[model samples]
Each structure stands twice: as structure tokens, then as C-alpha cells.
Target: MRRIPVRSLAVLATVGTLVLTGCGTETGDPADSTPAVAGADRTIRAHEVMQLTKVHEETGMTLLEGPTFDGTGKLLVVDVTAPAGKPKVIRVDVRKRTSQAVHTDARGAYTSAQFSPYDGRLYLTDYAHGEVVSLAPDGSDPRTFFSGDVDGARMNPDDIAFDEEGNLYVSDSRGLSTGDAHGRVVRIERDGKESTVLAEGLASTNGVSFDADYEGLWISELTQNRISYLRLDGKGGVASKHTAVRVDGGIAQTDSIAVDAAGNIYQALHGRAAMVVYDRHGERLATIEVPARAKGLESATNVAITPGGTRAYMTVSGPAGGFLYTFDALAKGVRQSNGG
Candidate 1:
């Protein structure tokens, strides 16, 4: 097979250097002016949960993103750049710090893995194929559960979230390369038949998750370097939205995020080895640095906090390869933390 260039998020590298002058007019409730990680809890030296073997060809870099836990207490992650014939999904034995291949397909560059609360099947975003597919519990029966044009155009589906009633919300991460660039959010009903545009005109929508109370959704915009809260109406469309918190990301870009039971957001950062914590109202709490000092561990793209929110498992990768690091959670983990 011919080589297909990887790095579905290659835009991150070019746009990461863009200075975060501001996050629009929503700076009234600003993050603290203190150092990003000042006086923050430096997690204990992390135990290497596992390492990925597959490496992409073009950049010679490997990445592990979309870390979420299965209902049976195992952590599931995606190999964002895994090429054809290689495992695209992995299951981690956090207790033993070992990993096993769960699924592989030649048609997709899987960016996110989320389980539907109503169906119990693992749903993943195929970044390359522009489709949201589902898998059986044992990694069988891969099928295109949702696909086709979103908002009159194709989408580069990035992160995913499932609501209490089994609705799927997706972030389309393409079209952010120019001044007119915008990201989109699409919602699919529980039956996977009807899809509606939830929100649009975003700046590189990356991480997406529901709030603790299910009142709204939290979206991480990479180019703008901020997180936005999409307040949902009774019909699940976006009611009102506001920038929750502006990330003081000097040279880094924001990625996926998880919301705890306390309504705090744990946002992952690309090009930096840290996760920033913020309250529901956009108050900056702390920035937790990556627990390891390895050369390539400086970038953590996604985090999965256990059900209790007592622990967090982050997916880290650079030239040194893909690694998983664990840290303590600032708030109790809730259903929103995992698989979303």
C-alpha cells in the first residue's frame, strides 16, 4: 500500500505558535495571572503505564490520544497516527501497567474512542475517513455508524462525546487554516439516523465533553487558546455559549478535555506537558505538569480520569514514542470524564 501521510492534527504545529492575545470579549472572568504551573501540585513521578510501537512515516512521530475508560474498568486509547495494518486502538491494564491491542483497521486514523452509555459499544472518530464508527465490546463488527457531509461539507471528526440518552456530539477539526477558518460540532441522535449541527464557527474545536449536570457542553478551541461552554436547550441544540476560560498557552495549543463531577475542566495541552484545571465559571485553578521528565513527554494530548476522579491517565508522545502517565485528579471523576 502507498504511504498516507499521518498527523491529522498537523495544523497544531503550524498554528501553535500563534500568540494568544485574548479570547475575545469573554476575558472578564480571566485566569489568574500567576505562572501557569505556579505552586501547583506536581504529581508524583508517574509510572509508565505503557508505550506504543507503531510510528508514522512522514514525521517519524507517534501519538496516543483520546484516553477513556471502558465500563469494565480498563482504559481505552487511540493511536492517532497508526498506519494501516497496525493496531489503532489499545486497552490498558492500569493495574499491571501493560497494554494489549484491541482493534486495528486500514481505513481510519482513529483520533478518539468513546463508549456509548446507552449501547455499551465503543464509538471512535475516524479522522482520515471522516466518519464516526462503532465497535462491539470485543473489538468486533466495525461499522460506519454515522458518516457523510456535515453542514454541507466533509468533516475531519476529532473528539467525541455521548450524552445520557445516547446522543453523539462530534467536533470537526478541519478548516481552521485561514482567517475564515471555522470548526463545527455535529450531533447524532441515539439511533444514529438523524444528525444536526449543534454549533459552528469555532476555532479548531478539539476536545468536547458534556458538563457534570448535562446542562451544556464544553468545547476546547485550539487556535483561540480557550475553552467555551455551549449551553444546551431542551432540544439539545446550542442555547447560548461563552468562553469559559482562556488558556495562557504561550507556545502550546489546547487539545482534549474532561469535566469532573465538581464541574471542573481538565484540559490537555499539545506542545506542552501539562493539563490545566479550571472551575465551571472559568476560574483557573491549577496547571498539572506531566509527571515524567523524558524528552518526548512534553506533550500530553488527552486525559482520562478514572470514574472516581481520584486518578488521571494522560496520553503523551513526542519523538521518544507514545507513553501513558498517571496523576491525581483535582475533583471526583464522573461519567463525563471517561468516554467523552
Candidate 2:
């Protein structure tokens, strides 16, 4: 299929600069397009859906790719500085809709955050420093956990995830203009042993996650407008990999993703100011619309779900600075719920 182009394509790399550029010129065109669903031994429904409500304009914290919540229900977000400024991490109280700057350093820009399954510590990546650091929630001295230059890959560490076995996965996205075969996913073990390259030739793989069954891995391809799945056979690595879902009229720039308890996958389709949900079979279940009140969410980078599964938290970048929004998902047994 032709490359899906929505709202995410132009923002991932230029987010810091473009978010301040205003929600670009409106095209005045309809927002309907067909998406591609790819995978092994599976075929799924492919298309885009419309929103039933206006975009929620409420603001929380300024972050690039976050809203990651902890066991305590506290959501941590990314603050990519104030328009070409510095970077920091902010904590958002979901219950009160209030936020506080947990760690704001004018000298560093932290791109992504992941909580270690085995230790519960926070693992953060610095795009500019080419380093990954870990800090306790108590805000102690941040220590270098992993550091490597992405020079040969033409990429940087963006988002991260953890498998059921406590393994760490990092998404290495190629530069703005690059294509698949450039993005990389690296796996880090508990002993700090690292093995790189799970799948190669992905069109900007930025976010990744495994299904509830832990049988398959899902990755967000920013430049390809599709989610790829890799099946796990034994453990050493993925047995095979293939495209799982493609968003029609969707931007190739997909950033972050999360999978619910039922095998449903949630992906942030950046640039287009939208979130897409896909079933286990790779069908597009629903597309959550984001109102572009500011920079049109240059790169809607990360996604988080409350432990209760009642809402999904998203981070978007714009001229008004980075903002976060919560999407109310209907409770499972609540009849008459639209799953909105």
C-alpha cells in the first residue's frame, strides 16, 4: 500500500521546533483512509473511524513521549523543554489532574521513561547524550545504566518497554527522512547483558509492546503507518516478524503503543492527532481522535493506561508547550458503552 500519511510523519524529529509552528495549514479534506493489517496467518479489518466527541482540550503536563504510570497510579511524563530549551520529567496526578516537576534539568533532555519490572526503578533515555540513565522515584543521584552511540544506525533511543520476563526493549528510530531497515530494537537483560537487532528494516520503529499472552511483539513504525508483530517461539529472539496492522489515512509516523489485558493493542498515530486500537486479529477496533488545539501534536509520542483500565493517557506536542490528555474508555461490562 502507498505510505499512510496522517499527523505523525512530520513531527517526530522536528517536534521541538515544529510544535511551536502552530497546527499547520488545514487541508480541508475529509479524514477517512484505509489502513493495512499485516501479520502471519491472520487477516484483519482495515480502515479509519471518526470520533463521536470533540477533542478534549484539557491540559496536564508538558512532555514529549509519556504518561507512563506506576503501580501507585502516578503518571510520569516527558517535558522536552520550552521550545528549543532544556528537558525534564514531570509527574501527573491523574485523580486531581495536577502535575509537578519531578526532575527538570536545564542541561539535559530526557526522551523516554520505562519502569523496570524486576527492580521498579525508572529507566530514562537521553537522545542528545546517547545515554540511558536510571533514577529512583525518591529522586536520588541518576546513574548511567546503558550508553551507546547510534551513529551507525542513524537513530537514537526513543521509547522503551519491558517483557513479562523482565527484559528491557528499546526502540531505535532512524532519522527523519529514513525508511525501514534503519530502525532497530535492542533487548537488555537483567544482568545488563545486551543483544541488539530483534527485527531489521522497519520504517521508523519508535514504540513497542508484547500481547497479554506474551506470544507476539508489537512495534509502532513511525514512517510506515503500520504496526508490526513478531511471534515468540522459544525466547532467545523472535521466531518471525510481519506487519500486524496498517492505519489508512493514518500518518506513517506512529510513535508509542500499549496492549491491554485482552490482547487489544493501542498505538499513537502522531501528526494526525489520533490513537488507534487494534484487536488480537489485527483489526482496527477504534480510532481515538485528538483535537489539535495547539501544534496538532507534532508527534504524539507515548501512551499509558491506568491500572484500572478505565482510561488511556497520551502526550502531544504543540505551540502551547507539550500537553497530555486522558481518554475515557468504557468499563468492560458497562453495557451501552461505545468503547470510546
Candidate 3:
């Protein structure tokens, strides 16, 4: 595997911070007025309207991913510590702006967590173990819900989402490099059986989300810097697939995605230090930069919207540490079928 030089990583991290802070140029608030994107209708300067604050900090919890919320409005996040250290799942009280570790298991690298509406339990992707696990909402009673290979290939689950019928859709991002499109989307039926829905043309599928109307599924390609949407057949299969949006210029590496009731897409643009908002037609709406306090962070990895869609929470990871940041969202989020 190729390694990123330490010096280059530092430079990238610094650039990311500067981009979010709007430090170098006097371009006069790109977020304030409408962005010059061809079809953009409105631009929301989120940093101005939404307050960014650090809610919690921990010394060893440095690789945080996934920020999901439950029906009651409690935010759940996962720390991706592995091998040498056990990963932890934490629950946060957004109202109180406080957090508590709910579960700490040494089994495998847990990267993402999703609440199952049908069972009212939290489902997590165990990347190292190549399977999915379930736990009580508070992170108790960890059990192997789905494991082993899917379609004869080792499962490297990265992120997860569910359809209206309670079936699970998982993004199996097999490797980190972009030379090969090894990523695949797997569907786990309500009965726990697994099948491959999409097995090609994806490089590092990082995030998966269903449209509010349950008509389309969005998958983020980390290394490819693109978002693909699949029209569902309403029978647990893809009717068609196509690219919804792509990040050009210097910005690449799209991460987890969140959608609102109005079908607007909120995608974390890792390395760019901003969250790019898109309308239902896949047109760029706005870019909400990360605050300057994330000075040494290389990227914002994941984003979660509140039930009411009034707020958004994102996780940033880099040399400085893992931090959770939030801001006001443009519209109310479509309440997840399964709590969050």
C-alpha cells in the first residue's frame, strides 16, 4: 500500500483549515451571496447563521465516524479505534450538549451505527470482522446480526442505511486505493439473508442514504469524489444507477451523506473542510465550511441531521483529534423510518 508522506498530510490539513476559515482572500463571503454554480438558486452561509461549538473532547478517542440520532433525539457516534484499542460507541444529548460512552467492545473496528426502526436496536458495521452487529439503543447486548461473506466476497462494511420495508443497504468499501473499483452495495433482507445489489463501478463507497420519498438511494464514492443515485425498483433491487453529483477542482473525497424532507443532500467534502449542499436535482446549493477551531483536521468524515432537520452534526478527524461540530440546517430532515 502507498503511504501518504507526513509532510504532505500536514500541508493538506493546513489547507483544509484555511479553506473553512476563509483566511487567505477577501472574496467577500462565498456563502453570503449565491455561489456562481450554473444552476444554483440559493446559497446559505451556514457559518453565519449556525453557531459552531465543541460539545465534547476525549484524549484517546481520535478516529470518530458516524453521527446518528435516535427517535428521542439522542445522538450516537462511533470511535474507529481498532486492534491495539477497543472501539467505543457514544450517545450524546444534543439538548444538553453532553455525551457519554455507551458501549466499548474490543471485537472489531466499528465504523458506523444505524438504528433499526423495526427492532428499535442500533446496528453497527464491524469493518475488521466484515459483518454487521446489533445492540440495544444504549449500546448493550452486542450480538452478531450478520457476518461472513456476501456474494462470495469478504464483507468490508463501511456505512449502512435501510429502506422502507426494513431491509438494510450496506456500502462495502473493500479497499482505500482508487486504482480498482472494489466497492459494492449489499442488501440484507429483513430475514437476514444478504445479496449484492451493486458490485461494480464504485471506488471506496463510503456513505449510503435513501431519498426522503424512498424513490432513490445515494451512495458516496470516497476516492472517486462522486455521488451516485440508484432508482429502486421498490422490490429490493436497483432499477437504474447514475451519477448524481461530482466534486471537481481540488476538492475530492466525499464522505457520509444526509438528506432532508425537501430532498436536499448534505455531503461532507473531506479534505475540502466543507459540507456541500445539493438540491433534489443534484444542483449545488451551498458550501458550509468547517469552523477554524478544527485547525489541524484533515477532513470532515461524517454528517447527521436532526429529526426536525433544523440542525446538523459532523465529525472531523485529523492530527488535532476527533471533534463533533454542528450548525443549523436548511430544512427539516426526513425522519428516519427506523428512529434515526
Which candidate ranks first by TM-score, i.e. highest?
Answer: 1
- Model 1, position 225, has a per-residue lDDT of 89
Models sorted by lDDT, best on top: 1, 3, 2
lDDT by residue for model 2 (8-106), tens: 322232323222111322222121223223332221111111111112122122346645776677777665432233326667775665766666553
**Model 3 per-residue lDDT tens digits across residues 287-324:** 76655543665666677777765666766665555566
Model 2 lDDT, residue 226, Cα: 79
> Which residue runs does candidate 1 get wrong by more than 4 Å?
1-47, 57-59, 177-179
Q: Higher TM-score: candidate 1 or 3?
A: 1
Task: Tell me the TM-score of each prediction against the true structure.
Answer: 0.86, 0.74, 0.81
Which model, 1 or 3, shows the larger lDDT? 1
Q: What is the lDDT of residue 288 in candidate 1?
A: 67
RMSD of each predicted structure: 7.9, 8.8, 7.1
The global C-alpha lDDT for each of the candidates, from Candidate 1 onward, is 0.74, 0.56, 0.64
Model 2 deviation from native, Cα RMSD in Å: 8.8
lDDT of 1 by residue, 302-330 (tens): 87888975677778777667877766666
